[model samples]
Target: MKNVYITRVSKFLPNKPVANDTMEDRLGEINGKTSKGRRIVLRQNKIKTRYYAIDEEGNITHNNAQLTKEAVEGLCDESFSKHDIELLSCGTGSPDQILPSHAAMVHGFLQNGNVEINSPSGACCSGMNALKYAYMAVKSNQVNNAVCTGSERASSWMQSSIFEDEVQHLKTIEENPILAFNKDFLRWMLSDGAGAFLLENEPKGTTPLKIEWMEGYSYAHEIEACMYAGGDKLENGFLKPWSEYNSDQWSKQSLFAIKQDVKLLGKNILSKGVESLKNALEKHNLNAQDIDYYLPHISSYYFKENLYDEMKDNDIEIPWDNWFMNLSEVGNVGAGSIYLMLEELVNSGQLKKGDKILLSVPESARFSYAIALLTVH
Candidate 1:
């Protein structure tokens, strides 16, 4: 098999960074009432700043397609252009439209040539899935080069206006006006951004990261959906998709609003990740000590310490010094997080040939994980 190397990495964070204290001011409050869980979630997330596609005046600045286009454009250089992109793979949890597909919209924005396109839709692991598609296409010699991205425009769905109908509907039914914690909790945590990587058969940069191996596992058979959107979770834990619900119920129930079963997430997330990580290492014949950098896409900093402790219990601890994270400064951009972290590290000029980087992405959407290994070349 041919080798695949990431030649360029780029990211686009829309508008300005919204501070912790001013998030509600940016996203707005539901029913003119501040969210009771806002402060608690912000404290646990430990995010100082995050980007949003909407302006302070709540104007549309960039949608998911535009954000992805901006990041993909960031890869253009004297050596490469959009015309040279043989394949495009894009992944996002929140797409601008459900009908035409996210990649089609991104390609329309690019207005590039007739390159083959793919869209892998999921939670955070969606980005890793996109990367795998590009990496495999290049490695298999099916394509000379590819551009892949993982991005999210969660602000669009999190805006208070999106939930206003549901709020009013609840009042009509004489139910609690306050949104459920499962619905409002993620509103405080997610951010808007896009990150792209250009993968090619040959390494281009002075320290291009070579794609080594990728592993993905889904525990959905063993567990129910822990995180979901565009659906409602039933008592039996089945996700009743938007298509099944009446069009009127869509707005009344806010079926499109992101929701999470926090109890299930907290109880099962870290342990599943740790075990999957251990298995991945064994499969690769690698040790934790071999990883020079450990980059993980953690939605909140609250899970960091707990995840580290769990890793230790599995006897697969990677030292804290080896860990690299940007969730604090950039917040959780969902799919784009790991790509952004990798971009920052690459731009940091801290790498040497042969340095190993382990990417740990856990998607609690259905208890799935994507673990990837890369080496500096």
Candidate 2:
């Protein structure tokens, strides 16, 4: 098979930083809890802070198309022209507009009509999905070069009125008002940022990271487990309010909100994720030990901890003693998590030639695992 390579990678984050201490303070004021307990919880996570763009009104910023465009421009500066690009893909949950894809808008800003563009939204696994598509395109000889970008502006989705409405419907409401705050919900784990990468067919003289192979798999289950219904009920900040009922009945609702996706926390997901990886690797005559880096979807901290344990139980020895955890700094960038992490590793000098990286992304009702062997040449 022809090798698909990553020639360049870059990321853009907002100028402001939200420290854990500050977040704790805010949480304390709302929860009316003692500072001491909050401090312990924040410290235990080892997450000092995360970042998000803010508006002039001092509210957390929403996805900024201009920022995404600037970030891509900065990453591709002087390296490749707008004309050389064949395809542009943007994986994101936050779109500036609903009609035109974020990728199409980006391509327009670049003033490049020659290049075809696609915007993919896979909830949290968008970055991996974009790469999977890019690799397929290259392998099939559809394009000589492609650009993939993942970005999110989650704060814009926060609606206090919707949350208030949902809270009123809860069967058991904690006495503490802070418990009622939306930030206390596990969905608040996500932060904001953008990442971009330039990919090309393995050129003769240019050094790039070679891609060996890529594969994907998806599984569907009960819609109640994870559905994107557009209603007033604030379930992880994505679904619409339930048309039938005004609130989420924790006991009566088919699914329970556990601060993390219930499927991810369950053992079934890990087993399925591993099985998907094993099948792909077997086709290539490889094994888990052959992989140098393992990048799973940026789920919550607890989900990560459980996943790590499950991998060990399956006898999958990841290269690093610990998985490359980036959520501490950026929170969960949703679909952009894997792509952003890949760029960070390359920039930080952690990824090198001939390294194999495994990516596992579980989104909504589907799960996907891809293994790409990189050869730096």
Candidate 3:
């Protein structure tokens, strides 16, 4: 087996930044009742602003493919040819189209004739999985170089009118607004962005990040389907297919929606994640003292304290000062969050030769956890 390393990483964020104040006005009463404004949510979550691939009128300005193309293009060198990439590992929370796999679409955009492509779509964890897949390919000598990307166009799925319409329909039952859902919570939280990494079997120019080891775990049964698209959870605990609904019904219910119990997620995520993380570390013989930096893909500010507490309880003590996070700037970008954070840290030029970095990504859907160890030199 050969060693795999990340030669370069790049990111492409939407042009416009949507401030918390702006969304405070845009996201109206939650579930048709006076609710905490977006500012409160933003402040509580420690998020200042986020980028969206949409215009002022809530019209989508870019699709997934465009965002992905920009990210990948930025990572490529001027002399780099499309054929230089031997594998394309693409992942996303929501792709523009289901027919054409996101990886294949990106491959087409790159005009890279036929390289092995894999599209892993498991919400937030997909990005880490894609990178892991690329690492395995290069480590096994299946590919010389691979490009792994995580992209999302969340604005298109965030149709405020759909939630408003749902609120009106539920009014007949006189259901409590709080009991129904605010729907706009995630709409105001998630942002749009794409991040790409070029991985190679051998070192490239300058310092390359050697992939030490990677591990993943899932507690899907412990958590319900929290984040998803193209289907709705029915009262009978089954997913109601989007095809069953009429065109008008589909417009409101078919897109992304969060019906999970946040309290449950918050309660179990940290403990469950720490347990899994500890196992991975023990398996690889890694400990807090060995890590130089901790790059965590946390969803929101709410989880920060929980994560710290869990780590403390589990005897996994990594100082917060040694961690890097971009939640305040990028919001929770689902699968793209970790990649964007890595790009920002790399661009800061703080990491030097022989740095050991620990990367962890935790997904809401199914409570999936992905962790990796990297060595920079």
Candidate 4:
């Protein structure tokens, strides 16, 4: 069987960079105990600026479908016609509509021939799931070529328009500042972006990157429903359906929120992630010492020490100097993070021929982890 290869990769950020203060200023204060000012949030998260699909006037310029289309179209190559793509896999945290899958919408926009379109939905891990599907398709000779995309329209969720009809909810937020802050902090930490990669059974060129291995693990039962959006978890721990809730209930429960037990997430994320990484390395009989780069898609620099210690505990000595991330510039872009990080690293002109890369993606919601091993040239 022919191995899967990523022929090309591309990323799209909707508009100009939006600073944390701009978001805070426009949204106003929701005074909470755990919540610091926007400046502090920016500092603690290490996100200086991130792109949103919003115009200068704070209006959303592109909807989810439009952004998804742009990402897929950007992945097009002059060497191959649209008809050549046999599969379209899209992963997203936010979607424009519930009826049609984001992948289907993207396919419609491209007017590309009818292809097997799959849209995998989740929090951050959704993108990796999409990639896994495409990888399997090509690796098994089910498709000659596939386009895998990860996109998010986070700006729409964070826009002030969402709160326009929730005066009482705003009052409640002000009354219970810490609880409100924790729920709303994700808006400041996240931005909008889309990334796409073309996967093929045959290498496109001499230097095409080869996908050596892929692995994913979940610890959903172990982690609380700390991060979520578009639904509510009742006292009984049953998540209420969106249609069952009224507008008022939606105001408080809708949108991205986090009841993060920082200690719990910090403690388990690295420990579990390292264990998964260990298994992947061992399964493939690959050595950590052979890795030329460690591409980690961590949400923030806050977890750096935790990751280091966890890897050390497992006897995986990947040096800190070998790791690369783009959270400071791009924030946590949900599903699109790993692709955007990889694109940035490639654009930096530091990677050379025959470089081995181990990419790690850890999602907060339900505590899932995904990793991929690849090699340049």
Candidate 4 residues 32-151, lDDT tens each? 122354555577788888888777765668877777778777766677667778899999888887778888888888898778999998878899999999999999999888989888
| Backbone clashes, candidate 4 | 4
List TM-scores for all candidates, in order.
0.98, 0.77, 0.91, 0.90
Candidate 4: the clashing residue pairs are 31-177, 32-177, 32-178, 33-178
lDDT of 4: 0.77
lDDT of 2 by residue, 136-230 (tens): 78767898878777787654443232234334444355543333222234334555677877777774323477776667676654223342323
Top-scoring candidate (lDDT): 1
Please name the candidate that would achieve the greatest TM-score relative to the true structure.
Answer: 1
Those runs of model 4 whose alpha carbons end farther than 4 Å from true positions after fitting are: 25-37, 164-167, 170-179, 235-238, 252-263
Which portions of model 2 miss their true places by more than 4 Å? 24-46, 55-64, 159-184, 203-207, 221-224, 227-268, 364-371
lDDT measured at residue 23 in model 1 versus the true structure, 0 to 100: 92
Q: For each of the candidates, give the backbone clash count.
A: 0, 11, 0, 4
Model 4 lDDT-worst window of ten: 26-35
lDDT of 4 at 312: 85
lDDT, candidate 3, equals 0.79
Q: Sort every candidate by lDDT, greatest first.
A: 1, 3, 4, 2
lDDT of 1 by residue, 128-186 (tens): 99999999999999999999999999998999999999899889877568999999999
Report the Cα lDDT for residue 146, model 1.
95
Better of 1 and 2 by lDDT: 1
Residue 37 in candidate 2 has what lDDT? 37
